[model samples]
Target: MNTHPLRWDALVFGVLFALVLVGWALLTYDLASVDGLAVAGLVTLIVAGLAGIALTLRRTS
Candidate 1:
């Protein structure tokens, strides 16, 4: 039997994944006119998006 505490539920992960997908879409289509700060934000978003994906995969496996 497994015994552990549940922190975030599936809905949370699902939302994170969905939001990251949206960020990726925005980065892809709107990167031409972004400033330096916007570039940094996009990079951070990419890293965070990867983290979200990895966490979701880890939770599943």
Candidate 2:
């Protein structure tokens, strides 16, 4: 039998992409205010930073 390692990078990219799409949809529908958008942007940045750190740690290990 053969096994393959999980693709964490692709998973992270997909999650981030989904987050952006959701934000875009909220803005399009006027469901989110300016402040909400700002918060979402900040959250996205934080998540990206964390993902970068995680990937780095994974590579080092």
Candidate 3:
């Protein structure tokens, strides 16, 4: 049996990264001011993507 973190981590990271874009678009609305929820969601998306990238690049050897 073989265990490698790379096998599943990449796919999951990619999905999360894609979801961030979708969340950003959906959260935006035309109005006088954007809601706090939208802003917070955007921030969360960015952090998640960056963290995912870092995790993926970590040495697996």
lDDT of 3 at 11: 87
TM-score of 2: 0.61
What total of clashing residue pairs does each candidate reach?
A: 0, 0, 0
Ranking of all candidate structures by their lDDT, best first: 2, 1, 3
Give lDDT tens digits, candidate 1, residues 1-61: 9997866677667866776676677668874444744676688779878998999999999
For residues 1-61, could you state the per-residue lDDT of candidate 3 as single tens digits? 9986676678867877786666566667432234754676688779978986888889553
RMSD of 2: 3.3
Q: Rate the local accuracy (lDDT) of all candidates.
A: 0.72, 0.87, 0.69
Error of 3 at 14 (Å): 17
lDDT of 2 by residue, 1-61 (tens): 8898999899878987888888889989999987988987898799879988998999999
Which is the winner by lDDT between candidate 1 and candidate 3?
Answer: 1
What is the C-alpha local distance difference test score of candidate 2? 0.87
lDDT of 1: 0.72
